[model samples]
Target chain A: MAGTDPIHQFVISDIVELFTIGGDGTEGSGLTFSFTNSGLFMVVSVVLTTTFLLFASRNRKLVPDRWQLAGEMSYTFIANMLRSSAGSEGMRFFPFVFSMFAFVLVGNMLGMFPYFFTYTSHIIVTFGLAMTVILVVTIYGFARHGLKFFKLFAPSGVPAYVLPIVIPIEIVSFLSRPISLSVRLFGNVLAGHITLKVFTGFVVSLGALGALGWLGALLPMIMAVAITALEVLVSAVQAYVFAVLTSMYLNDAVHPSH
Target chain B: MVTQAFAQEAETPTEQNLDAAIDATRGEPVEGAVGHDPTADTHATTEAHGGEHDSGVFPPFDPATFPSQLLWLAITFGALYLLMSKLALPRIGGILENRKHIIDADLAAADASRQKTDAAIAAYETALAEAKSKAQGIADQNRETIQADLAAKRSAVEADLGAKLSAAEARIASTKAEAMTHVDEIATETAQTVVTQLVGDVSTDSVRAAVAKAKE
Candidate 1:
């Protein structure tokens, strides 16, 4: 902890790396057709989410226990947001929306643990997620609304005289959803972690004065704690916003006239 | 026989006191009462709970097999989506549809009732107006009949009075004429008698006096 290089120390290699197999002589990496770190993390997130929901939903008492209540509240929060934005008609999508929320929330929280990578901070992962949602929305829009869904690109009540100008702008704006949604999540996580890394680097570089700089160390410590809390909030909000927007997109699929 | 059986069932005095003492101290479990019991049951249950390898607790991560991550995500997402579509969604849909139907029916019934109440109120008002008009018409008819009856009775009385007055006048005239005739006849008879009795009687004067009195 004292003599290490914090900047280089936190650098996670992009290549698939091997992890030990317990009581076996096998090696595994992300693409090795075996268990991988990212795969394990994904599995962990799923298992955690599943167990929590199972335990929480077991009795589903009107007066909920603590963990059950927390789970229920999370579910209701996302569901209500979707419903409010997309209407009761959007309740049909609750399962997908709920799963998305749970997945993103658990993934963000799991990455917050020491020795884990912020998977969402990585572009490949974020891009993949973003593309998946975008693809679903696109296909659904077409399947549900047909050619009328293309009207989503051309908003109604826009003055016919302004069509040439407005349509292009609208198209661009509509296309930006996936990009903006993905970048918003990716940027927030990447920025917070990077900021943490830099401050921690300063704390290490200050040498024995690092302890003397303990008072100065309070700054990074406060930022870390504050940023951690903010990150959790951002995690929940991003998931909610994403789900809500997805529902809105679906609403457009259902009613392209709007 | 009952007394003997009761005595036989009752504990001896020393044993009864001991039983009371044991019940009293049972709150403090005897040290070895449960101490010798094996923990096999607990161990069995713990093993049963962990029958699956899914503890959900954080474990080591390996990066070599990334595809499995995608596979797990795909599988879970697929299963959940399918189950939602197949099972949970249909039930939720039915509940929502039923709720919607009930609400719509209630609203419709309320609307129908409101319309019915409005119609009833209108009819009542109309009936009240008609009754008022009928009552007014009946009163008018009664008034007209009473006025006509009074007029008819007054006219008949006036005509009868007029006729009677005329008849009485005529009778007075006739009576005056007859009186005059009688007077004339009486005068002639008196003159004849006076002339017969004594030529000294003034038959003209007496006749003139009688005529003047009759005129008066």
Candidate 2:
């Protein structure tokens, strides 16, 4: 079957978005409002997580079963991650970070299936998520530190005369966070999917063959399976990476050294 | 109904020890005795009878379940901690206490046995000493009689020996006199014979002279 227009399929048209309700000018502008493809996958991910947790908790044995142990490990892991990254100074934000973690984890997972659209592949979705996190840190930073957040762009080591040259560059670097965040996630996921698709096409297109031709088919097939497993790991890693970065920004916001 | 009651009476192995302890304290008769009763057990009986259980009990309970899996999980964990605290922990503690009591009783019994051993050893020693002293007394009594008899035999033998010694001395003196007489006679006879044989026709004086010369 023919593929959809890649440009239109995973392009960012409108600017603003978010999952959780927060004090913001734009809430769910593009995909979060309706029962779209992205929404379906989000629902699927939540349902799956809920089911697994439920089954795991049902027995309630002192010595946990395998699934229960996994659930417990995951909870502890995320909790510890939050504790280390955000520190005790920012514990109230744990649920939000955890929620974000859960959302991306599911989003990445849903995209991995064949004939499925990677929500993360879309820049708008990723940008919107990053912006929400960035926006939270920004607002909280301003609230807690007042006007002192401007110091985040200016370091102490730079000479007074160098402020004119250095401040703009720092400000641009700091402002480019959402762009980098969105692009990194989107590019990795899209590239992974496209690579898989291209290799898979070789497998089918190459007719049944001899030593050289069989290898041509064999290599790509192996790569496809390998990439699938890798994607699972990468998906979890991305979520963790996102959460950690969010925490760092929050840390910077709360305690701005420069 | 009888079968049902008997079946219920066949309590689980896990519960028997616990039930036995409870029955003991409650002044109830032991299980399998003549008056053993399934209805006697308070806890199991109460649960089975359920006199206070209403039909509307747990009305909001839903088997299909809401999206409260996460919430239920938290509740489940809390409930488990409670069960460990209330039921499982206390039973284990009671078992440990009983084991300690059994060990203490065994130690006390061992101490009593050691004391008895000590007493027995003392009694055996006292009997042995009395036996040894009685044997010594018997030996001393026998030694006195033997010494007395030995002295009497020695004195009688000395008396007999004195008489024999005198008789031997007398005999020796008489024998000595006779031997001297014999010696003189033999010498005179030998001289007469010798003279007769040497000089048959010689004169008496000449003979006497020859004899005197021979004697010299």
Candidate 3:
């Protein structure tokens, strides 16, 4: 039942329990050099992303084939997204935005595999990415505008008497951006995967009951299939959302105005 | 053990027997055997958590794997960023630029060739027109020269004919004057002969004066 449990699918189990420098070679010892399933999938995601981009553009034709078109489509998709949100100047952070989009997209897609772990479903990964974007935006904002960046907290149209209330509210909201950004992806992917596992578990458990159970199990199996399909769409949309949101944040950094 | 349980369940027909078997298997000494093998312990724990789903609830919150996940994420993302900025994007940009250059060059070459063709046509038209006009001018000059030459020839022929006629007329007039003189001498001789025969010789001076008055 534990193995069939939907929640267990997200577990980060050790693939190879590695050793530290010295001492009794165990898990929680000197240095944890353990490789987990989560890490394996992360590596897989990265390799897939690299392979796609590298080989897709190897021939680099004026006219593109299917694979090449897919590669270019992704590039332009992010490029256009950045332009729309942050303008041409925001293209300066193209490398960062593109990398994040590819990583998250690949991670989400790979998780659709039955046994593969979805790293983006993990809050740490999403948080790390979101924090990086926010950090870069903050740094760029300060570097570009210096003290004027703080003016973002107190918007231009605010009345002089309402500075204290409005400024604090704005500051809190600004700080909450990374939280909302990370949680949105993690929560969606996490819930979607969990729901799929639960439905799949129902198929197994219900079938175990008997002839009646077997007939009954068809419903959840179909539901599972449907959820899987929905999850696929969600995966793609989340990646888009992540990239678009990053572009918007970067836009704020570049402009830093009301 | 789970597979064995399932196989046994499949063999058994009744639901009660399957439930009993499941219950009996659940209370087995699997946890005690976990001390011998860590993998067994994990499996046992996993089986134990089947009814209660609390053991591996949320992995991202687990502090044990965070450092490793975070570490690798940083390394991978950083590498990706470097690869993107240095290699991938620039390669695409280069391909696009090259395509653009080729297109522009082709367009310019086409335009140049079109202009050259236009110029060639214009030149041919002008040459053809010039030749046509030149031929017309030569024809007009030739016709004029032929007419002038014919006129000069006609005038020379008329003057030659006039000279020959005048000479012929003068010759006739001289011949007529000689004959008339001869005629007068003959007439006087005959008249004298006839008078002499008729009545002793007629006078010669009287015959000559009569002949002269008759000529006037």
Candidate 4:
């Protein structure tokens, strides 16, 4: 009964009060500068990512040790993903893509631990990341190709009659990219965590019935364990999906064609 | 934001229903009802605290935390990007490049050494063939010089022997002629003496003639 609140885990509570502007930070009415659990985790993710990479690459051996290999493998993995989705020219965005990937991936993995806040589960956080990607793509596209960046919607080889229908649809879909991108990650993390919490809650609730209930709790316990594993996999996959999609969107900025 | 508000509105009813269901189950009259009451009371109080904390809004959809979260995200992500670009990526790239260079250098050195060995073997074979031919040439020259000297010495010995044989034959012929003349004179003298003794005071001329006729 105690752990039965599935929605309670997502609560963002302040650890330190910094300042507030325009209002007293109540009823979503003010710009609060308080450091919350979400901010703490963000800092944790950054520190952890930087420390691991820096420590892993400390000894640059010709025949790399396990740690160095891990560092090198992650480097190549993001590099290859970007280069394949975009071209070698896309490598200019390597730092950005790598940072995005590391941030999301680390955040997701950290959330798998009990009592850890899942920042990626928040729509606003995911949406901000998605919007940043879209902003970069748009700005770079316009800078590089000028008005021709609009050509992404009006693809070539469309029949003249279908162009009227296809262009608007394409435009709408294009406009929906950040929404879809942000929602996909947010929804997956939110739902998976909720389901895991719910199942785990069932175990606690049923086990309150004593000996008979303990036997019944086994099924939910197993389900919770299985869903936790699945959520771990989903966390990694969603991060990869975010990075890959970012690269592909950047590709449109670089090429801006069908 | 509106959709999220609607979603929160929609989710609250279900959560309340689930909470009610849990409470109903805990409220069920069991053998250990007396013991379960205290635990149920604690659950109710904790639920109240959770409700106050959440404030009827889903935490993920709560706009109050957005500014702080976004600010932190920007700060942390910017720091991560700078660290990666400035430090980690270049180091890894350099290590890989260095390894490739070393391996290529090693391969080139090995190739050069193999070529030197091949050249040395070829030179050794050529020198051996040259020495063998030179030895054969020296042996042939010695054999020809010795054979020429032997032929010259045999010819000189044969000419000297032929001259000595002719000279000896001539000397024997001359000595036999002289002996024949002497023998004729001696026979004449002996015939004359015999005639004088037989006839008293016969003439020398007649004796000589008779001796000549007998000899004839």
Candidate 5:
């Protein structure tokens, strides 16, 4: 009965009280600087990613050790993904793309632990990431191609008679990239966690009914274990999806035609 | 009994929560109910903490936490980007590049050594062939020299044997001539003796003439 509320885990609670600046730090009040569980996890993600990468590269062996190989593999994975989707010129944005990938992946992995806040489950966080990608695409597209960047919506091969219908659809699709990107990740993580919690809650509830209850609880327990494994896979896949999509969007900035 | 009561109490709230969730989805508010909606519970908790902005919303959908979350994200992500670009990526790339260079250099060295070995083998074969031909030439020269010496010695021996055979034939001819002379002498003496025994003496010239005439 205690952990039955699937929504309880997502509650944001402040760990340290800092200051309320403008109004009262409420809905429309102003900005609040107090460090919350979300902030702590963000800090944890940054530290963990930095330490792992730095420690892995410390040896610089020709025949790499396990940790070093792991580090190199992650680097190559993201680099190749960006280069293939975008282009070699897109290597300019490698730092940004790599950072986004590592942050999301590490954050998702950290959230797998009990009592850890999943930052990617929040729409604002994923939206912030998606918006940053869009902003880079838009700003770089304009800076690089000027007025010709609009050619993205009008694609080259379409018949002139269908331009009127095709242009708006293309524009809508282009504009919805950030929304789709953010919502896809957030919805997946949110739903997966909630489902896992609900199934686990069923096990606890059933186990309280004496011997018969204990026997019935086995099914839910198995289901909960299976769902946990699925969630782990989902977390990794979602992180990869975020990076791949980010590269594809950045590709538009590099080559805006088709 | 008490355990059973507790189990029943837990089950009742779960059923009520499910109904409240269904009702909330239908856009109908359940009135005069305590802890019926889970979001309401979250709302009460936030309100109790004097946070006015997220009082009646799901925590994820609440707008009040956006500013801090964004600020922290920018800080942490920016830090990650700086650390990676400056420190980690370049090092790994360098290691890979260095390994490639070393392996290539090693392959080239091995190729050069293989060529050297091939050249040495070819030289060794040439030397062996030359030695074999030289040995054949030496053997042929020795055989010719021995055959010539044998021919010379055989010719000298045949000449020496021919001279000895001629001398032996001359000696044999002389011995035959002497024996024939003795035979004639013996015949003359015997003739003389018989003549004397029969009737007085016979002359040597006559006897000789008679013998020569008889031999003729």
Candidate 6:
């Protein structure tokens, strides 16, 4: 067992291990299918977001209450982001963008709690989301523009001699979009959580030492507080960045002019 | 300090057994043994111990846990997408749309009422101006009529006074003439009495002729 390790906070624990359907697995006999803390937190975020939306707009008054105003603001915030990035045509994918934004935002925020898991910090989850966005954009591009979608890789003013170099580079860059997108989010979140944990570990180690050590621990404690505040801002910003990039990619699929 | 702790965990019998189990599961020789853990499922055992937990560097990178994580992510993402697209989002959209419509209707109604109030004020001003002009016209007309009537009355009064003055003058002239004749007769009578008393009475014809000559 790993004891008192700050990195242990990220470990996904199996809450319920299953063999066949809901059947209990014997000890180390068969491979265990399990529900994890990561999954639990994801579901929690979904529920929270859904309930917030429902309760906020239940009254739907012309003069909005606080809850209703909050709901409206988030809606308009995403709507405007999509509209500005992808134009009026981008409003069709409003729900998708909003969902991604809320999911990431809530997940990051909830993970800031003392013992909660941050699924967005995981490469698999973030990559899955990124791939989904890319897949949707590719499919939509092909569906809307047919063969003309391939023109997105080729610039309009490029010389025929430069086409060989430019097209490959563009294709490579285009393919790297998902990787960058996923990594940026995951790296930011993971780094923030790790830094927070490290600082906290410092506080614990110092406090455990002695009277002088407790006094020294105050510095890292202060740093942890500041970092927590920064992480909150980062969480919101990362969610916004994800949503905006998704919109931009969707815009490329829709227009694909340059 | 952290390195020493990890090294201690590595040296433990339970840690060795756990590492062997992980190695057996992955079918790899446990040759490189510093700061490396093959399986994420080792956390399940560590968590079961209740007093300690596994501290992998990057647990999410573990291949054994990818299936379940991806599966759960897919299910959750699918559920979220459907909820947002079909239900939650549309409801919010409806609320926003309805609010916009209501606000627009209210603003339009306010504008129309304001316009009506402006028109009413304009009409009131026009009526007041017309009434003031009409009153002034009536007063001017009445002044002109009164001035003309006064002029006619004054002229008629002057004419009647002139006629009466002339008549009085003529009567005075006739009275003076009669008085002169009487005075002449009286003078002749007085002279005749004086002459008679003195020597002899003068003749009436002679007195009358003398009086007439003197008057002339």
The candidate maximizing TM-score is 6
Worst ten-residue run, lDDT, model 1 chain B?
B51-60
Candidate 6 at residue B150, lDDT?
Answer: 99
| lDDT, candidate 6, A1-258, per-residue tens | 243466677777776643333324433333345678888888898889988998997986778899988999999999999999899998898998999999899999998998889999889899999999999999999999999999999989989999999999989989999999999999999999999988988888899999999999999999999999999999999999999999999998888875
- Which of candidates 3 and 5 is the stronger one according to TM-score? 5
Best by lDDT: 5
Q: In model 4, where do residues sit more than 4 Å from their true spots? A: A24-28, A156-162, B1-53, B108-216
B82-130 in candidate 3: lDDT tens per residue?
8888888777667767878999999999999999999999999999999
TM-score of 4: 0.69
Per-residue CA lDDT of candidate 5, range A193-231, in tens? 899889988888889998999999999899999999999
lDDT of 4 by residue, A93-201 (tens): 9989998999999999999999999999999999999999999999999999999999998888887889889989988988999999999999999999999999999
Candidate 6 at A241: error in angstroms? 1.5
Chain B TM-score, candidates in order: 0.44, 0.41, 0.41, 0.39, 0.57, 0.57
DockQ of 4: 0.33
Candidate 1: regions farther than 4 A off: A1-34, B1-216
Considering DockQ, which of the candidate structures 4 and 5 is the better prediction for this target?
4
Cα TM-score per model = 0.53, 0.46, 0.66, 0.69, 0.71, 0.74
Kindly indicate the candidate among 1 and 6 with the higher TM-score.
6
User: What fraction of correct interface contacts does each candidate retain?
Assistant: 0.22, 0.00, 0.48, 0.78, 0.61, 0.56
Candidate 2 residue runs with Cα over 4 Å from true position: A3-34, A54-63, A156-162, A208-215, B1-216
Which consecutive 10 residues in model 5 chain A have the weakest lDDT in total? A24-33
A1-258, model 1: which lDDT tens digit per residue? 322432222222322333333434431212433333555566677677766766665654545578666765666686678787767876777777766766676777787776775556654455556666778777877887788888986678888888898889878887887788778876776676666666666655553485678777677777777877877788777766667777777677666767
Model 5, docking class = acceptable
Per-candidate local distance difference test = 0.61, 0.61, 0.81, 0.83, 0.84, 0.82
Candidate 3 segments whose C-alpha is farther than 4 A from its true place: A17-33, A157-162, B1-57, B107-216
Q: Least lDDT summed over 10 consecutive residues: which range in candidate 2 chain B? A: B59-68
Model 6 DockQ vs. reference: 0.28
Can you rank all candidates by DockQ, best first? 4, 5, 6, 3, 1, 2
Cα shift from native, residue B167, model 4 (Å): 27
Docking class of 4: acceptable
